[model samples]
Target chain A: MGSGSGVSCAVTLNTSLTPEQRALYQDVGQINHLLDSARTIALVGLSSDRQKASFFVAGYLKDEGYRIVPVNPKADIILGEKVYPDVASIPFPVDIVDIFRPAQEIDGIVDQAIARKEKGIDSPAIWMQLRLVNLAAAERSLAAGLTTIVDKCVKMEHGRYRGGLHFAGMNTEIISARKRKR
Target chain B: MTHRPGPRKFGFETRMVHAGHVPDAHTGSRAVPIHLTTSYVFDSPEYAAQLFELKQYGNIYTRISNPTTAVLEERLASLEGATGALVVSSGMAAQFVALMTLLSPGDEVVASSHLYGGTVTQLKQTLLKLSIKVTLVDPHNDAAWEQAITKKTRALYGETIGNPRGSVLDLEKLSRLANVHKIPLIVDNTFATPYLCRPIEWGATIVLHSATKFIGGHGSAIAGVILDSGNFDFSRFPAIAAPSPSYHNLRFFDTFGHYGFLMKARAETVRDVGACVSPMNSFLILQGLETLSLRMDRHVGNAQQIARYLEQHEQVAWVSYAGLPSHADHALAQKYLPKGPGAVFSFGLKGEGAEVREDGKKFIESLQLFSHLANVGDVRSLVIHPASTTHQQLTEEELAACGVGPEMIRLSIGLENVEDLLWDLDQAFHALSRSIRA
Candidate 1:
């Protein structure tokens, strides 16, 4: 984000976003359902770096009692889990194929997750991360009976499901009873 | 580190005014109060013990932390997008504290040759006595940095904009080199300030300022601040990661997480060195910070006009402002400091040899508006001729290497109307030309 210039993309922020795009961006039910039930997740495009958003999210989820399988051909390991080259190469069944790729790259990742389900693998849920949206890919997965989530981070959903998502100054209580009565 | 939003989330101007402060809680005071007191009251002995032991966070001594200084620290830390900050008495002291915390005997630092004269002395002379070796390299020459590094090389140091002359730094290249060498990049951001550039955004692990300068904006107080990016992994650097014999064998990195270096500097160095700022100075600097964007805007705007005026003047040989298209670092300036090349810049006189040095002195003496001074970043214009003043003893050849010619004059442009400043220079040049002909 600080690479090209130290300023935000103020103009590119879509104030006139289409209705469907806005709804897809704000869809918390599908995200909550996918996050609440998924025990094991395959993190697509996971970086080895601990500072990157993808790696930090994966680490947080892992600490929250979720098993994570990092999928990246660039490395052999991430967060101590053996990284698979592709989702189809995961030796065990994955309940969720969580994506951390950009918008254009989402179709290619969804194609892999859809192929896994057709070959007698567990009909996995598809989760696309923040700023990643493909309405066409999401529709195809929905038509194939695979639960689909777009433009939402799976870890943030789990955090919200447990109560609130805290980024910047925005807080959603992600915990139920962490606070005590005096 | 306390869940503050990134500077990217707020516009630069918005962050300037509201980054590290909020309205007063009890009195609902809109102004940041000057917290004047020597010590903070603790609720109980247990609370005092916890604060002392670093088990809990609260202020005990004004020397280590104060409410007024905390606002300034947070304001600057937010502006620079740093995880934490430690405000000190002066820019030199900030440099001393950061280096002291990071270096032990036998450690080494690879620094840029283009630095303030005082910094050159700090590295080349005083710091060597502590057994830390510093090898100065030309920052523009990447290979010189590589050649200077040894197994003991602990860090790399440079300024956001080089001193005396405003030579912009190639932040991307320098940062990549530091990362590859497994070292942190420390940047002295006194000249640029966060208003013009945030060094942390360009991978500077530590960013510091002579808050006495532009951060104070009025030359009202002497202060400095050290900002930690909290991005560097200290676990690989043994100085910070290793267990401390004085602190119950506790390792700072293991205990403080991302803020280990600053925690160590605050707990050990600031506590020991005792160069912390007074609450009164902190309040004054905060007032300076609140208007930094407005002041810097005019400062840059006025500097641009004066630099162009001097460039075309008959008596001027060369101008060294990064904003000028003719400068050697023009492209680097556009990349790193797009908000304008800042207020302070230098230019050289036209004559050669002994006559050149004489005209430089005459020009300075003839200026009616610009005050001859030892400082920069003042509300009023300032002029200094190094050949006749600061570097008077150095020969022409020696002065050239340090970005100064015997005929060079440095200017710190102020917020006054441009016409007045240009008129003052014109009359000075008239006096200079008459003396030259006679």
Candidate 2:
């Protein structure tokens, strides 16, 4: 029988992510920091349908006090906010540009975010929704000194860190035997 | 270890100790700290609104969710391989919330006849007040269970190991039956904790535990937990699938998907009814959960010895422990509870009618080391005459239905040395024999 002190491995226990992958994706402390400091989020591909994941996430982020800048070409307005056609078209600065678009469209989005960063229109960090990842696009974003997070849900990370995910009992991937103190 | 890309699964013991919590991020403390506040501070009015609307996850009031209790919920969910878990004030509260959440007026439930006495009353009597009907059927009889279901039947309920009766549920057979009928199977796993069986793995959509029992093995706290497997498609269940007027016509199933049932159970039922668990009780249960596997091992070992001893004893009529090969459910127990059929079991005292009742009481009163009490699953050995104590509320017919006869004496074998427990039982039986002669 093994001791209950927890596994000695240096990787996260909940998921089978490798050490390097864990540092990249499962460093929830970093995600928590990002969620804490970032304010406005430009939600690319925010859908008008209430059933869509993007719409739910956008609405959730808006409720969490983050200003949601909807970036969808199909709609003039979504979630009660005026929608931008693209990242470059958005006039005001956004702290994070969360993508809900397909993986094939990520390279173009990253290029636009880089152009906006150079022009000082927006130096927004890039976040891809769960199951939408583009390694090449992430590399380009990182090269432009933009923090690039892939395949993670921004609303989920916010809920996980703020102590809300337990309300419905979703595994937050945080493994520890000790409790948190206020 | 080979590198993997998805979430790494921890062993059961590892999960029991660390699955739900991380160290105090601010204080660097390695132990679970009790957050005793009645509520939490929100970032703003908007944030509070988000919490109330269920758009965001965070604490608002202790009556709804507490950080300390959340840890317990998470740890138990992890151990049970469930998608999520909710903790309530007591074992009965867990059963009530789960049933009330799923069943509406006119809906029906088919449950095991072999169950804790209070549960039978709650199902047969109290739920009738809501117009929700329940049919009691033999747990091992699949055909009876099938015949009991009708168009009104929404959920099938049974214990993994029947309380006091010690009959093991055929989880797979019932789950299959539930699936064929497009209903959910809810199981009470108080007797077989995750260490022995995970009902969810066998297709139970919802699993319940009286944490007041083995999960809080030391009997230091009273609590209950309900876990959702997140495997059931509730798109047809009206309570979950249909829009609710209570929350602006929000459809829990359409919105939360896999987590719909639990989210409704917490946000709607638990929020309104207010049978929430105390953070102190949750903390005490967490302490018990840490050593659960180790304690269960010794508990089973002691129980197995006692069951065998009682089976051959001159004063003992029959032992109903599934761990004993003579038990009617012994084969089923081996399939579901290979480790052992838990620490609690019942044995009948030798005699008939009034004489047997006297023997049962005398035997309990004469026990020197074992504490005679109504509760079970404690570190210290406990004994109870269910006909006179726990099951006293039931009529003679109901008593026989749940297998609690007047001669039945229940023993919750604990973590004491086997020889000492055997000695305690021997002395008690000897004292009972002398009293009968006198």
How high is the CA lDDT of each candidate model? 0.77, 0.85
lDDT of 1 by residue, A88-155 (tens): 78978888888887778878877877888888778888877655677788878877788877665565
TM-score of the A-chain for all models? 0.77, 0.86
For residues B1-438, write the lDDT of model 2, one tens digit per residue.
998655455688888888777765467667778989898899889778767877767788998888889889988988888878999999999999999899899999999999998998999999999999999997877789989999999999999999888999999999999999999999999998999999988999999999999999988899999999878989989999988888777788866766789889998999898999999999999999999999999999999999999999998889999999899999999999999999999999878998899888888888988998889999999999999888888888888888988899998988888899899999998998788779
| Per-residue lDDT value at B237 in model 2 | 95
Off by over 4 Å in 2: A1-56, A63-67, A71-75, A84-154, A161-163, A177-182, B1-7
lDDT of 2: 0.85
The Cα error of candidate 1 at residue B286, in Å, is 0.7
Q: What is the TM-score of candidate 2?
A: 0.84
Model 1 Cα lDDT, one tens digit per residue, B204-295: 89998899888887888999899888778898788789887766666777555566788788888888999989989988988888888898
Worst 10 residues of 2 chain B by lDDT: B3-12
TM-score per candidate, in order?
Answer: 0.71, 0.84
